[model samples]
Target: MLDKVKELNEKFKTASPQEVLEYFLKTYKGKIALSSSFGAEDQVLTDMILKQDKSAKIFTLDTGRLPYETYSVMDNTNLKYNIKVDVYFPDAKEVETLYKEQGINGFYESIENRKRCCFVRKIAPLQRALQGLNIWITGLRASQSITREAMHLVEYDENNKVIKLNPLLLWSEEDVWDYIKTHKVPYNKLHDHGYPSIGCAPCTRAIKEGKDIRSGRWWWENPEHKECGLHKK
Candidate 1:
């Protein structure tokens, strides 16, 4: 399976982003869905999917901590695309348990607490998002983080039991912006202020001029503790 995954990745690495999306749309028999955080890359994908198939399932995780601008972008995307974005929330029980145990400020204490918060807020909902899906699309690129540097354009996600397709993995940041500009894709207003990757407001910040892409995320933590662990697949 590993060898097959490598072979598929090699093929996908050279495929055009359009071709990849088209292939997945048919390969998954239109059962495929995309998760968008409304970042630049995500907006670009939303545009592409809307253009290709208006009925495509586009969804977001309402982690309850996103910026106001993020929600604004989400609203604009829906208005522009004339499509409904299904939203998923963390389980009620898990959220209640965590809030009771650590309070709302749990993540600020330690890496373990942060992971626990992310698990309840992200990983669990993400699993629910992929249920009964054959292909899951993302806005991830290789340059985003060290852990993601090892990622391929197409890989099997054992964690979610689905085929993971990162259509933009080979595309550069300039490439994403170019498409967005040419297509007039709706994007987060905060991007103009230096936010390349936008997640929850509290967990993300603007990057310095020379900081690594992952540096802006969880900036207070050591290099080895960067990932939120929800992307482990």
Candidate 2:
């Protein structure tokens, strides 16, 4: 599987994102799906994927703490595409246990607590969502953060035991916005308010003009520890 991933990376290194999607969507058929967060990059991919295959699977993890704007764009994307995106949520019992163990926002106290929160709210749900899938598509870009710099166009996610595909891995922030504008794709309103990265409401914020794109997400943590375990390598 690792060798296959390596081969795919080589094969599509020079291919456009649409070309990559075209091959994988057909090859994997019902086995491939995109996990969207309704962000700009994801929105662009959604447009591309739906244009190619309206019945393509696209799902999102609703952490129950997402910002209103995230939900707003989710609705707009559904309306624009005329498709109901599948939604996955954390286990109710796990969420209850998490709150009991860590109050309302204990993630603010320590990195350990934050990771635990992410596990309950995002990672665990993501695990469930990825079940029965051979390929997991994402909107990750290398320039978004220090953690993502080493990512490839296609790689095996040993943790999830699935082939992880990052269609927009090489896209620039400018490239993403250009595609968004050119296509008139529906996007989160928070992007207009300086939010380069959006996540659960409490874990996200708006960054200043020159800050790192991911700085707005989990702003309280060091760059190396900013990830919420969803994309952990």
User: What RMSD, rounded to one decimal, does every model reach?
Assistant: 1.5, 0.6
Compared with the true structure, what per-residue lDDT tens digits does model 2 show for residues 1-233?
97898899999999999999999999999999999999999999999999999999999999999999999999999999999999999999999998999999999999999999999989999999999999999999999998999999998888999999999999999999999999999999999999999999999999999999999888888999989998876
Superposed Cα deviation of residue 51, candidate 1 (Å): 1.6
Q: How does each model score on TM-score? A: 0.94, 0.99
Model 1's TM-score against the true structure: 0.94
How far residue 168's Cα lies from its native spot in candidate 2, in Å, is 0.7
Residue 168: error of model 1 in Å? 0.9
Per-residue lDDT of candidate 1, residues 1-233 (tens digit): 66766887777767887878887786676679989989998888888777777788888999988899999999998898888899999989989999998998878899999899999999889888888898888999988777788788878888877777888987788899999889889889888887877877888899877678677788779877888866687
Q: What is the C-alpha lDDT of each candidate?
A: 0.84, 0.94
TM-score of 2: 0.99
- In model 1, the Cα lDDT at residue 200 comes to 79
**Count of backbone collisions within predicted model 1:** 0
- Indicate the residue-level lDDT of 92 in model 2: 95
